[model samples]
Target: MKECPQQNLIVDYVFRELDTKTKTEFEAHLKSCQSCQQQLREFKAAAPVFQKARRIHHPKRPAQNYYKTLKENFYPSMSLAQRIHEWAADFFLTPSIAMRVAQAVAMLVVGVFLGRFLFFQEPIPVAVKNETSPILAANVSDQFLRHYLQETEMILLDVANTNPAEDRQILSSVKQLAIYRQLMQKTILCREHAEELNDDVLANLINEIELILLDLCNTEDENLIETLQNVRRQIKDSHILLEINSVESRGI
Candidate 1:
């Protein structure tokens, strides 16, 4: 069957973020949806693992120039003022970081006006072609790909370290489940965008991780605890994290 339209809403269902009426409708929809059931199952299985992960993590970053590379991709020809302003606006778009409404609105307006003025002031010369900067573009693209790969690796590594016997009980708590659901939602976006970019290597690794998340989210079947135990084993066997490190060093 094709993926369910209600798939994204399942996150809300897990977190109790839905209103009474919407929750009622979602529960009804959830019953027949095997895809969503799998998502829920994996979320349950992964919750405690993620909860424990707060105390365990390794910070990994790509080249420091990645940000500079990202900025170059955005406003290669724009004036400095326009470029700086838009970069600031990008931070406001991040939901994790709070931006006051008044500040965001003012910055947004300034950005719009600045952008319009910069691009229209002079007779717009035909933009230069990428023949001179193909290598730069490729570096930038790979930088983004590696950044995402590192993220998936860290999250999976943390999930893998969880012990099924102890974490199984914690998985059932409402709070743990909500956090797990949120992490999975972030994973969904990462996986989807990677696929859109046709980065098969990164996408395939993430898909393996997604399979585990889906299986863990919905099941309290204590019988599946064995399956949960194997989650870490599966990640190590895949050697995906090592592969990412290799790629990074090789400058892919």
Candidate 2:
């Protein structure tokens, strides 16, 4: 089947990521394209399956006390070499086929537990640490700042391309508003770090972004279009998107 260029937007549409104008355009395309319609139907059909899979309860593992007992009984009775020899002989030379298979399975399970007890250490929660720390604060790297800028750019594009006439909900969207609040808070955190760096230009740009986010979050529905237009103009005149791209490329 010939592919439609608009098919790529189907995921965004299903996820409600597309801004109003792009979503309206894609919906129009969806009406005309059989392939995209079928794909969308498939996506909808698969949603319940995924939800059910997520809710599935997995079988619980043996308790720690079970392992403790296994360790006490299995490892302390003999020397390591004697245990290995006995295990090997029991596994390979057992006259009963069922007994040999049981021994093999037990050995496999025991080895896995033994290896875990010997070498497994709890992993450091790096992502948690990064998230809790301010961007570029202390030992945190500049990657979080780059990621924040990229997300801001995407939100800005969504705001810029929104059609005021058709997408009256653009400025009032609950999801978008929530995202704006989050980004604004993150921007404030980033501003403190930016000030510490002593780079006036970087600090000023972040300040501008914070101001834009504030306006976006606080604009009244009655003045939505005017606010959107002003925002688009501000973004274009300042070339903020280009600056974001440049900063992303040249690391802080």
Candidate 3:
């Protein structure tokens, strides 16, 4: 005999989970459904045995009602942030392997962010006429732009050489994005310095590199090949690598 669709609802009915209308519909169906009826009867008959076994294996233990003892003082009024802070402090104070690992990770993350914030500010504007010599300022600018160009050239070369068809795993690589972000941050600082020095050539080159990096970072996996091809074309047509080498050789 075929099983009734409502057979599964028998458990819900026994546990009083169904609402009134659905419960009534299930009951009316139960009167005419012999298979569901027999199954329900068997389940009800076996429930007492299962409960007895559960009680034997896992008897209840008596415990103190600390909340009742503390009464109104059980939960002190505190802001959500304060409560969360206290809870986190209590949880990490516990001596467990997972807690120790989590605390270490949290500290490491905080340290990394703090270090970046402290060290990665934009290059300080050189005091051209007042404090530093013109030659010294020029050398600083040259070193800054030279370093930026070298790093940008390296990243571009890597992207240009990547064959999406052969190296499919490049789509999921984490180091690529990390390098992109690092270069992008440096580019922002470089652009600021370029503008300060009024070097249009260096500023324009920085702009182009920034756009390429932004595109590379935002490209979706499906369009990664196309984006890479476009970036290579931009780099080649602009003679970016040749320009970088020329700038570096001439001391920017």
Top candidate by lDDT: 2
Clashes of each: 15, 0, 0
Model 2's alpha-carbon lDDT is: 0.79
For residues 1-252, what per-residue lDDT tens digits would candidate 1 score against the true structure?
467788888767777899999999878878988988888788777876887888966444655577678778884678889988878877556433355676778889999999998875753221222232222222334455566557656756766776767777765545444444544554566666667777777677667767766655554556547766676677778786787676566553
The candidate with the higher lDDT, 2 or 3, is 2
lDDT of each: 0.65, 0.79, 0.76
Worst 10 residues of 2 by lDDT: 132-141
Put the candidates in TM-score order, highest first.
2, 3, 1
RMSD of each: 38.5, 29.9, 16.7
lDDT of 1: 0.65
lDDT per residue (tens digit) for residues 3-82 in model 3: 87779998888878999999999999989999999999998888778877876553334324554456547766788999
Query: Candidate 2 lDDT, tens digit per residue, 1-252?
Result: 788777888888988999999999999989999999999999878876887889766554747777778889886578889989998887577647888678788989999999999999975443444456443345334666677888999998887788777887756766567678778877876777778777677788898898889889877688888988888898888888887787777778
Error of 3 at 197 (Å): 1.6
Arranged by lDDT with the best first, the candidates are: 2, 3, 1
All candidates: TM-score: 0.35, 0.44, 0.43
C-alpha lDDT (0 to 100) for residue 66 of candidate 1:
76
